[model samples]
Target: MNGGDGPSSYARNSAYQRGAIEAAGALLREEIHKRLDLANHTRSSFTIADFGCSSGPNTLLAIDIIIQALLHKFSSSTADVKTPEFQVFLNDLSHSDFNALFALLPPQSQRPYFVAGVPGSFYGNLFPKASLNLAHSSCALNWLSDLPPELTDTTSPAHNRGRIFYTGASAEVAQAYSCQFKKDIKSFLVARSRELAEDGLMALIVPGVPDGFLDSQASTGSEFDLVGSCCWAII
Candidate 1:
C-alpha cells in the first residue's frame, strides 16, 4: 500500500523510490516516445497508474517525471493536438490516507496532469483492461502479503521459535519466505499483464541484495534476527 508516515514521515523515507525514478529517466523517456509514436501523436489523452503509491510528495515526483517525459516527447512533434490531458491514478490499499495525498497535490495552475486516487491492493488488477499507457511502482515490492506460516508453526520443522522474521534462520525459513514471495509476485504479474494495453509499459523499482547473499544479509532484517542468531549460537 501507499503508506509510510502520515505525511512527511513517508516522504522522508522514500529516497529509494525517488532515486529509482530519476535513474529510470532514459527508460521512461523511451517508452513515452514509443507510446506517442504508436498513437501517431494524435491520441487526445494518456493514462498512467502508479501502483502502491504510499503517501507524500514522492508519488508526486514519480508521476511528474512521467508527465514531463510525455511532454518532452510531444514537444517537437507535429501532432495536431497541443498537449493531451494526462490522467494519473495514485493507488494504494483501502486504508491509505488518500486525503493526505490529495492535500499535497500541486494546483492545476502549476501542472497539467489530472490526478485521482485508487484505493485497493495492487497485488490484483486495479485498472481496466488496455486502459493504461504506463504503469509504475517502486520500492514497495519487498513486502510479502503474509508472513511465511511455517516460521511460526510450532509443530513444523521450519518453525522459527522466538523470532519474527526469517533472517538468520535455517534454509527452510528462507525457502518459506521465498516461496510465498514467488506466489505473491506471480499473482501480481498476472493481474498487471491483463490490465496493461498491448503497447503499455511498466516501470518498477525493487530493492536488491547481492548475488550469493543469504538471509543473513537481509538489508533491514528484523530485530528478531539478532535473538534468533544468538539462540542458534547457543544451541
Candidate 2:
C-alpha cells in the first residue's frame, strides 16, 4: 500500500479506478440524501465507516460523497442547522498501511473530519452496535475474509488441489468456494447489521467477472479464470 510508486503500491496506482469509483459514488449521493431525510436526521454530527479502505486517494472520493450528501441535507433543512462534523473510520487488514493513509488525510484546518483507522477483517465486527450512520465499500467484497479452508484439507474431501479456484474444477471444488463465499458474506452482513444504525445507509461496489466465468455467487471474480490456468503452481 506504500513506498515505491508502482503496480504494487496501491496509493500510487489506484487512481486508474478513481474516475469510475467516483462516478459510482456520485450516483449514490442523492440516494444518501434521501435516506437522511427519511431518517428525520437532525444531528449536527455523524460517523461513517469505509470497509476495506485500502490506502489510496480513491477512498476519499466515496467518503466525501457521503459527507457532502449529508451536509447538503443539513443546508436544505427548514430549520436553522449548523454544518455537520464528521467522524470517519477507514478500515482494512491489520497489515495495511494506515500511516500512509493518515498522511494523505487533509489537515484538521482544511476539513471538518476526525479520521481514524480500524484495522481488521470486515467479516467481523469492528465498531460498537449502532455506531455507524453510513458504511461504504469499493472493490473489496470479491475477496473472501479467509481462504476456503476446505481447499487445504485433504481428508475433508473438498481440497481444491491443482486449481487456484473453482471455475472449471470439479463440482466439489465449485461447491467449496460457493459455500465459503456464502459464509463470509453472511458473517460480513451480520457484523455490519449490528454496527450500523437502524436507518443507516450502505454503499458497496464490486468488480464482476464476464459471463461464463465462475466465482463466488456472492462475489464477482474478474481474474478468477486465471485460477484454473495456474492451478498446477500450487501443487
Candidate 3:
C-alpha cells in the first residue's frame, strides 16, 4: 500500500482516514433521507448497504448514525402503516477489517435489523438483483485500479485534454487518466445496475474540487451514479 505512489495505493490507504470518513457518513445519512423523500416511498421496506466500508471506528460510527436516522424517520407517524425491517450489508475489499465493526453493535435495539459483510471490490455486483433499498458509499471510488496509460506519454496532443488536478504530469497522461476514470465509472454503474431495486436510493460522497472545477467526465466515476443507473434501469 503505497498511498502516495498511484491509484491503488491511494485506494488502499486513503479510503479509511478518520475525519473524512466520519464526515462522509454524516453526509450520507442526510442524503439517504433526502433520496427517500424524493422517491415518495417513505413506508416501504428498507435495506441499506455501505460500500467500501473499511474496518475502523469511523465506519462503525457512520453505521450507527445511518441506522439511527433510518429508525427515527421510518418509525415516525408520517411513515407507512407498518414498520419495515432493515437488513444492512456492509461491503468492502476482502482484506478490510471487520472485527472492530462486528464488536461495536449496540445491545438490544428496538429497530429490527441484521448486518452482513460482503467481501469484494465495490466495482462488481455484491447483492441480489433488486435487493438493495438504499446504498451509501463515502470517501471511496476516487481510487481507480490503475492510472490511465495514455497520460504517461508526453508526445500526444490529447495528453493535456483529459488531465485532472495533478499539474506536474504531462497533459496527455492527465487526459488518459481522466479517460480511464470515466470508463471505470461507467463500468461501475453498469455493474451496480444489476443489484439495485426499483425506486432504490443511494448516496455517495467523494473527494473533488469545489465549484465543480473537476472535469465532469472524470468525477463521474462514482458509486452513486452506478447505483442510481441500476435503479433507473429497473424502472
State which candidate has the highest lDDT.
Answer: 1
| Cα lDDT listed for each candidate | 0.78, 0.77, 0.64
Clashing pairs in 1: 2-53, 2-54, 3-54
Query: How do the residues 37-68 of candidate 3 rate in per-residue lDDT, one tens digit apiece?
Result: 52355545677888877664455656667777
Write the residue-wise lDDT of candidate 2 on 73-146 in tens digits.
77776755666678999999999888777877788898768888999999999999998888888888878767
Predictions: Cα RMSD each: 4.2, 3.5, 10.6
> How well is each residue in 1-235 modelled by candidate 1, as lDDT tens digits?
3444544477556676677777877787786676555444346778899988887777888888888887887676765566778889999888887887888887878988889999888888888887887888877777787888888899987887767677767888778888988998998889889887777788888876788876566756754566667877887
Query: Candidate 3, which segments miss by more than 4 Å at Cα?
Result: 1-18, 21-31, 37-45, 107-112, 149-167, 211-235
- TM-score of each prediction: 0.83, 0.83, 0.67
Number of colliding residue pairs in each model = 3, 0, 10
Q: Of models 1 and 2, which has the larger lDDT?
A: 1
Model 3: ten consecutive residues of lowest lDDT: 1-10
Off by over 4 Å in 1: 1-8, 34-36, 40-42, 78-82, 222-235
